[model samples]
Target chain A: MKIEKKDVEYIADLSRLELTGEEKELYSAQLGDILSWMDELNKADTSKVEPTAHILGLENVLRSDLPEPFPDREAILKLAPQRELDFIKVPKVIE
Target chain B: MNNFETVIGLEVHAQLNTATKMFCPCPQADYKAGANSAICPVCTGQPGTLPAANVKAVELGVKTGLALNCRVNEISIFARKNYFYPDLPKSYQVSQFDRPLCEAGSVEIDLKPSGSKTIRVARAHLEEDAGKSLHALGSRALDYTLVDFNRCGVPLIEIVSEPDISSADEAHAYLTELKRILQWAGVSQCDMEKGELRCDVNISLKAAAVKELGQKVEIKNLNSFKAVKDAINSEIARQTAMIERGETVAQDTRLWNEKEQKTVPMRSKEMAHDYRYFPEPDLVPLRIAAARLETAKNELGELPRARKTRFMKDFGLNNYDAGVLTSDRCLSAYFEACMKEAPPSAAEGEAKAVANLITGEFFARANELKVNPEDYLSKTISPVSLVKLAALTSAGKLSASAAKTVFAGSWGTGKTPEALMGELGLAQVSDSVQIEAWAREAIAANPDAAKDFKNGNEKALGPIVGMVMKKSGGKANPRLANEAIKKILAA
Candidate 1:
């Protein structure tokens, strides 16, 4: 699972990140150490242990049939990088 | 033809009908509200914030498994599905691994001409929805790619099926049935049109005599069932042609181009070793107490299958009628509401006629409008008005043609059936005297056709019936028209 220096460079390119030579070497070692821990996790006995998806094991959580109005409109638009007249503005996708 | 059998499996992602997203109390809003409206810091994957799993989502996951006839797991767990994309926060996703909420469920789907097949369900688990990424690669009108976190952290139930499907038709049937069950159970909208429901397809081809499978290719992002069928059929053709040419199918994730009608390799598919799934440290093991599961099962109102059977038995509907009505929970509610005050007075049988009126008239119009049965029921049409209308139609006071017009008015104005009929002056032409005159005119105009009817040509009756209908401005109750025409023609 250890990400080698060369593979890390390739992945960083795929991820569109600008990495310096020194930072790349440092991250390679750091990623390798993390992978070794994951290796330990892969070795654990999961044969008898069931995988948990969500806590509480509750079932059938549903919304009431009543449709409610959108709340806190002003608060949501504030988090956007750009906004125009109470709207979050972004690059147009379709030509 | 080279002898190669297709081995196909399906991974279905169904958005839970939960009010809030899986990881937080943020409302599960996919679109419409606004960008980032439903997102929280936990969903945005801020550094110090942790997520608390949505318990309701887990319950829905188990219920979906149970519906497919799967055994519920005593303890289920979650793992991080590591991936890096702008849409997915934290560069990873929390999902189920070796332990799933339910295992060993199977759905039996019927295919026309080919009969039936049982698809084995591998497992079902809960997961969170991802944020959306808007790509503006080739556009000058945009500065950079856009994104919306409105869908971030919405709940999802994923069902994995064994490689049991061999044909596209069977796959379509399985998905259709699965959507029906989830919708009827009040679990999910499963609306492929809205993108709330989605599917990932796995396909491979092996030599007909080969016992094992060929290289498996996973295809992603097929939204519609038609698209699934088209993609699979095209892949089978492509794989078969390749194998015939001594070329091997590459194991990878291919994106299905619905418009181009082919699968193009997005990238070489990852082996499970790549994602490196590990149990999430923040989440604990989900324990399903037997009592809780039992209570959930009890609370699950009659499922579509059971309700369909009862509609056939108790409601005196045929198999098709029962299936059509009970396939949708909302439509079924509408049907029962219409039947509530209906007086059983059919010349044939009371319940049977009542069932026919519902399955025949109401559903016919509902389908034409493409309205979800629930939305139709949620509107102003009520049982009292519906039953009163059915009684009028049964008593030969409302013609079928006129009923359609009145039914549309009932939907538009939210007016009771009687009020609409009174306002429009659409009462049936059951006055034997007035209908008899039109019947006489119709018989005389089609003298030869009438003679043909006398000569025992049963089909001639149809033309005469149409003539009488047109003569009455489509207002003649069919039953009264038939009797009046018979009496006049005999005279």
Candidate 2:
């Protein structure tokens, strides 16, 4: 599968990323190379193997439904670029 | 110029009543708390944060599916739905895409004046909720929006209904029954006012003469069931008018404006976001064991429809009364508890008596206290006390009028019916001797009426009975008082 410039532009727009013309061309070639490598990997016969979502041998890692207090309130709020009276302010977002 | 048929499909988002966020340990506390106070690094979308699924949320999703008679899948996958918004801290939601938890379920909605209609549920998928963007639209000082991550990472299940609904009333009934089922299964609170339940409606109008469907328009921000019905109704009208005017209806997203009572366009179809969905790498496939599935099915308990049918068949309650009793799970449980304690011989009568107390006086008291009936039952009243009150009214030990007084006074006081009755002097004076004395006094006082009564004037007996009731401080059972008055008059 070939990744065209338009496809890269559409993906960048979806991700809310702004890319220059040169960078868009660069990513188009880079993404196409990545896809060709994936195609090469797909050529091998792996039909007997099961599709794996996670490679780790981990399952059912869960926490009980008991709640503890959130320890760092002020620090979390300060991480935001703009803050007003314990709230994180951003550009107005209408529906 | 042409008759049209409306098609509506609803998508409902129900927040799970979990103790913490779906992927993090941040407490899902009330949003009224200080903003950012409940934030954790994982929920705040900090880099290198890994998310783990909540077992309780998955269990709740399964329970809901079983209650709706859906086919629960043994394996489901979580996918990353990538999008960008201020409220979505992670810029993507962990949601079920190709594989959902439940599928192929249907709900039965009762229609007016006739039979019930079945709405097909396409699928129900588990997802994490986004935070809310608090907008300062009308304020003069700040015109920017604020972000609150308190709601981020909360667990939710999105139920998508097929386009089987033909009218607004049927749509409303579908949502109402769905909410009741979820609440009964103890899956979610399903409270619309608290944003625990939200709905989005998709509607289109097709000419009755044609078989093809028209362009579909999506409506959002419906905070209540009534809003959903109104939005669908008005959207149908708007689309029908457009077609009549020889204009094609444009597919768009609209918001329900409660003040104007109309749906206004929020965005056009061309601006729709492309959610690039891929399998989530951080979480493993959720595998439901056969034992776990059996446990969920057993935990569903008696659903509303079956319980309502039983109340009608076994308890001999009418349709409307049974529906009112089974509407709330807590109420039905309370009634069943009362029935177990009622006298064995008069079980049907006692059940009706308890139902009346709950629907009548109990509802009124709960309204006055500004609490939900179920909450009131747990906090203010006890089922044993309620059964005893019904028993008193049934055995003729308490006058019906005095029962009302005792009900009002006993709310939240932890006083039993007997204690309240004793303190208020509401016990019935059913002694024949005392009743005869009052009847005799009334007879002697009114010589003219007494003579008329002895002359076989049965209507004249009413005044004597009234006087007897008044002399007993209105504590005499009116039926027994009437009988005693007749006996005295005949002698």
Candidate 3:
């Protein structure tokens, strides 16, 4: 489907985009061009071609019916943006 | 009373039984360990890493749908549900919207009022899971929430049911049966406590004429079955009160604040723009070949409801006992393994009584030991032992009360029930002479108690029987000993 200017703005808002009018209009046209390109691509002569979803075609990859070691507390806390003792710190929400 | 009907639907997210993460080779990991450790660039939505779909995850999704009586879609598409969250590394969750993997099935839930009712399964789709969110300073605990990426890109099968549930109880039943079926089909462990198996309920209350339906208020964060039930109950009351006050229940999501035991609005209702879903070009349509679907179907041993009924018919077990047995795949297998070892020929009531040991004594003992029975189930106990113990009680060789002691002793020492019985000299005497001799000794020693037994003070039969059992050193089965004592006293 072709992307309309209004639809682009709506999408931008959903995406939390903070754009000036000029940037919004610019992105609207760019996105519209991309959608039109996809539309053209849809018209390929290969009618028998199946759409692909996953990269690898392996089916039913499963873990053993056992629980392996979960990450330890130290390993998990290392990625926290801000940490004290061992927890991810976010802005204080409770008054 | 207002003539209103409640419409309830459920969306259950069951983590599939896969060895690897949904799109990567990271060990199908745990969520308890916080951020980044379980993550790879592919899952973290790194600038350039690509996701290779986990095919087995899709088969399980289809297999799950088939068990729920859903029709596996020929070509199912994956889409990106865009939302910005710290825990979601990609900032957009890859999901299915229009063409889900499976469609149009139903799950049968046991209704207390009626015998059984089938709730329509709207669809079940495959999706990638989000990462863990740890509240800082009890921040998320208190309001400040932080993200942990450990769970990101985990494969999940979202099973959504049609709005067929009329009450909260049916919703609860539907979740229960769905979890049991998924676990039994060897798809997922379905441990709700672990959040491996989780559920969110959508409930709306509308007047009888309001066929268009009222706004749906989705309830989330119900960890246990009891919590889910209570949330539904309280939500119904709250909705009813609002309706009575002539207020509208908005379309929004609410959290079941388990600690507070109340439902609170998580966010105001949002339009479709909230999570703008668009086709995901990274992945291709999931294909279901007829042979594969059939294979998956054959692989599914039995659904919970069907297995429960069959357990009663084939094993002569009761409904409650059968339900308990089939709640989880491993537990059911444990019961069957015990039966296989002790087959019905060896014990008349082994099937029913075996479950009692598993759900009762075994579970109780395992709890005391603080080890999950599932961890030791395959190794520690034998069905033959269970059957032998039950048979002893049945043949009047051991009393029911005595069987518990015998089982604990045998189980604790890892000795065979027969061995324990022999060593403890708990074997009951069936010999007429031996039984009579014990009874005669009891009569001579306890003349007053024996006379009371004859004079119709039937309660006095207790001490005389005790004397016979004591004379036999508690090895004699009390039932036969009592009978022998009664006969000898009468003569």
Candidate 4:
């Protein structure tokens, strides 16, 4: 796969990141290198290998459906830039 | 103008009734819980936190899949649905892609006024619920949004339907049947009120003669079944009008503006979302063991359609009555419980009578109590009491009016129907002498009607009966009063 500047820009926008002209060019080239490397890696013959979602080889890492509150809920709630009461405040998201 | 056919497909998100969220052990209990209260590092997307899948969620998914007759995939992988939203702490939702846990199950919806259609189930996949975004604060005091992450990691199963529904009514029937099945299977509560079940409707209009489909418009935020039906109908009208005006229907996302009763564009085509979906690296592929799959299939009870058919066949109920009886799983179970209390063999051919009481007065009382039939059974009236009431009404010992009184009283007070009837003096007054006196008074009060009745005006008989009922203060057995009035007019 080839990486383009517009693709990088679109990805950056989707990630909610603002990119400068220079950073966009830098990321575009960096992504191109990363993609070529991935393509080179993909060239290896592994036709019999099963597709994997996780590298840990864990098939079913699960927890019982038991609810427990986070120990430091207050600290976590305080991490948001803006909060009212218990809620994290942000710009209005109209549906 | 052209004749157009409306085609609608639905995507329903039903929150699994699991104790914990999908990827974390945070309590799913408090959607109303204080924001971030239920958050764990994994659910809130803290740095370097790993998610462990909730086993109960997958089990419920399998159960739902089997109930819907979907092929449950032994293996399914979780993927990252990448999007930027403040409500989604992870910035991407963990959902199933490509390989879903269940697929290709169809639900048969018996449409009202006649006929049935099989709606093809496209897929049902498990995912996580995003936290609620509150814009009420923006409209209230400040121009800002509030987020509650209590629902952040709650597990959800998204059931996507094939575009087989060609009319708004069919779409309604499909949702109704799907909700009932899921609810009956104990997979999810499927309550639209609390957002347990959410629907997004995709619809488009095509010329009846045209082979290809038209531009698809998605309508979202339909909170209730009626809203779903109305939204589809309104969207169909809107799209049909747009096409008739020689205008191209642009693919856009619309919100059901319930007050306006029309869909308004929420996002234009240019602002459409591009959800970059890829497998999540944090979680392993979900594997359902053979034993778990067996349990899921075995645990499913009689589904809504099967129960409805059985109710019609076994109890000799009509289609409408059977449908009403089995519409809610709780009600169907309650009816069965009532039958057990008064088994059909002992019911003296009044099994249908018990069904009538259940679908009629008992349902009304249940609604009035604002409790489901199951709760009503445990809290207010027992199945035995209900069966006895039905039996009494059937045996003519308790008049229908008296039975209705007992039914309502039983809900208000915890007393048995017979006890309530005794305490409230609502028992049918079947004393022949007392009924004769009331009838005589009724005949004397309406001399003209009596003379007309003797002259063979059967319609005049109603006035005398009405007078007798009024004289009896509505406690008189109506059938007995009618018989008494006929005898007096004959004499």
Write the residue-wise lDDT of candidate 2 on B3-120 in tens digits: 9988899999999989988888888869577677788888888899898888899999999888887899988888999877888888889999888999999999999876899999
What does candidate 1's lDDT look like per residue over B235-263, in tens digits?
99999999999998877778888779899
Structural similarity to truth (TM-score) of each candidate: 0.76, 0.89, 0.83, 0.87
Quote the positional error of residue B251 for candidate 2 in Å: 1.9
DockQ ranking of the models:
4, 2, 3, 1
Q: How would the docking of model 3 be graded?
A: incorrect
Sort all candidates by TM-score, best to worst. Answer: 2, 4, 3, 1
- Tell me which residue pairs clash in candidate 2: none
Question: Which model scores highest in TM-score?
Answer: 2
Candidate 3 Cα misplacement greater than 4 A, ranges: A1-9, A21-95, B138-145, B268-274, B337-359, B366-378, B399-416, B489-491
Isolated chain B TM-score per model = 0.83, 0.90, 0.89, 0.87
| B96-190: candidate 4 lDDT, tens digit per residue | 99989999999998777788989999999999998888877544755788888888889999999999998878988888888888888888888
Query: All candidates' lDDT scores?
Result: 0.77, 0.85, 0.76, 0.84
Task: Name the best candidate (by lDDT).
Answer: 2
* Backbone clashes (count) for model 4: 0
Ten-residue stretch with the least lDDT total in model 4 chain B: B267-276
RMSD of each: 6.1, 3.4, 4.7, 3.6
Model 4 earns a TM-score of 0.87
Q: Which ranges of candidate 4 are over 4 A from the true structure?
A: A17-30, A41-48, A91-95, B29-31, B138-141, B267-273, B346-349, B404-452, B459-491
User: What DockQ does each prediction reach against the true complex?
Assistant: 0.16, 0.59, 0.21, 0.69
Deviation (Å) of B285 in candidate 3: 2.0
Candidate 3: tens digits of C-alpha lDDT, residues B378-416 = 455566777678666777777666677788887646687
Question: TM-score for the second chain in candidate 1?
Answer: 0.83
